[model samples]
Target: MADLSSNAPPNQIWVAVKKQKVWIASGILLLLVAALSPDQARDSLGFVAQSLLTTAPYLLLSIGIAAWAVATGADNLIARAFTGSPVLMIFLAALAGGLSPFCSCGVIPLIAALLTMGVPLSAVMAFWLASPVMDPSMFLLTSGVLGFEFAIAKTLAAIGLGVAGGFIVMALAGSHILHDALRDGVGNGGCGAAKIRNPKTVVWRFWNHGDRVEKFGKEAFKTTLFLAQWLTLAFLLESLMLAYVPAETITSVLGGTGIGPIAIATVVGVPAYLNGYAALPLISGLMEQGMAQGAGLAFLVAGGVTSLPAAIAVWALVKPRVFTLYIAISLGGAFMIGLAYQGWTLI
Candidate 1:
């Protein structure tokens, strides 16, 4: 008998079983709801399914492009190019982060590596803060769902956040405040430096190396699965919200350009927001219901910066004071941007 255990990961098995359970539970819940209220169940389920279909292509393409970038050693090239003056490096790091297609979780290992490589904390912080806000894949999808102006504004906001965070950290450079920041000096190393064996033969040998090919395939597939699961869950939750939550209620609360509304949006966003990929449709729905553009943007920025996953990753790697500063910069920058946008629109 072939030993199948060596062929797949143990966690994968658990994940598969958990997914099966989710499907089973969802089916049973749907059946029960149908038994109780057939029309409501039908509408909600249909909306959920539609939402899944709508976002599938973007999610797939984003992960695929991101995976390819890693496999081709392009991300490494970008990471290694951040050596320069503080201002220049900070700007470049922010730009790279905006362009790189990575979530907060995905960027943690790179961050560790960069720090270990002696990259300035300022530049590392710049990239760390910027990368999760927007990427090529997210930009395309956001442009499609929202407007071009909104997408452009988001990209700028991400870079701006990175710049602000980087400069702030630079200012606190010699202070004892950030002296105890790094909790760990290394990461799991799974996402460590990408090594290109032969630059000239990379194209022809890309598909020839069995191990490399396997690695890329596994990564791409895993990414697809991870994103699809989140997207599906988010769509389902959105469907329920749309069905149960009154549109007028959301609008009345978040429709204003006042500091109060923007502040609420930012604070609420820290806990309420999900992954960037999952939050788009929900944000869109809220916008359609009359949410202010400034408030919506603030919510996205704050959540992207201090999201649970991202915050946890940072907390695990850094000390209390550094984490506090990270949160402060993110929150403060988000509010300023939102307020500025509101002012721009008024003028």
Candidate 2:
């Protein structure tokens, strides 16, 4: 018989490394330990399960919204509309993003595509910052998990920051920064190219167009593929967070006394890039343990906005200066909002 260990494939060599084996073995051991310690495992598992559950509704809503936006060609129309007037574009972009239910990852690709189609950088930035926080899915989750008052507060805070940040970016960078990167005539292409029928003439097209079934099938396939690619990275990040971070750590850092908690929470959250679903349990736990509302809100905004994947994606697509500006704007906005929440509560 062939020597099984000696004949292992090259790919399996890395997996057989002592360090890797030890790490894997240690992980299994830790899991067993946690399982034996029912109370600790229960708390940790509960936190992760709750996080997943809270995020599920928002994920579904966001995917549906994104699919509709793509299928109806609303994305292109909105980009074109914004190109006409910079100020109007900023407001409309934020409004559209705020109302839609897309998470940060789901929205990033769409925003990147829009930028590639020549949408204003300021408007794109506003949408990036606002969408995850103000979207209906987030609103529903926030209200469901926290309460209506907290949801309303979050919505208003996100909008205010989005608008203000858009204006600031526009003033500093100029609209030209975005137009230079976009594909030529991206928005100007007629909807006919995509075989999109006018909403008013949908009935007529259904009756007249013999290939309507084929066209519908094509649209569905494209939308599904687009959504799958969009969500893949985000889902991976959520899984990692669920697997690694401890609930007590989240609660302690975010719930500590004074501005220190807010600062620590912001620092921890800014780099995480988790969706509200992955973040909900952590935030709820902090709140339940007497973490300041303002700090928890800050963590949510920071985590929602500045994901590492989105940052890397942005960096690859835009100029270094532009990408740096994007990160700064998001961080600054989160800090300001957190500060405002703190101030309001103090008053």
Among the numbered candidates, top TM-score falls to 1
Q: Clashing residue pairs in candidate 1, if any?
A: none
lDDT of 1 at 59: 67
TM-score of model 1 vs. true structure: 0.84
lDDT of 2 at 191: 36
Best by lDDT: 1
C-alpha RMSD by candidate, in order:
4.4, 8.0
Weakest lDDT window of 10 consecutive positions for candidate 1: 193-202
How many clashes in candidate 1?
0
Quantify all predictions' global Cα lDDT against the true fold.
0.76, 0.60
lDDT by residue for model 2 over 168-254, one digit each (tens)? 878877455543544333343233223212222223233244465455456556544443333333333334444566657656666
Colliding pairs, model 2: 273-307
Model 1 Cα shift for residue 266 (angstroms) = 0.5
TM-scores, all candidates, are 0.84, 0.63
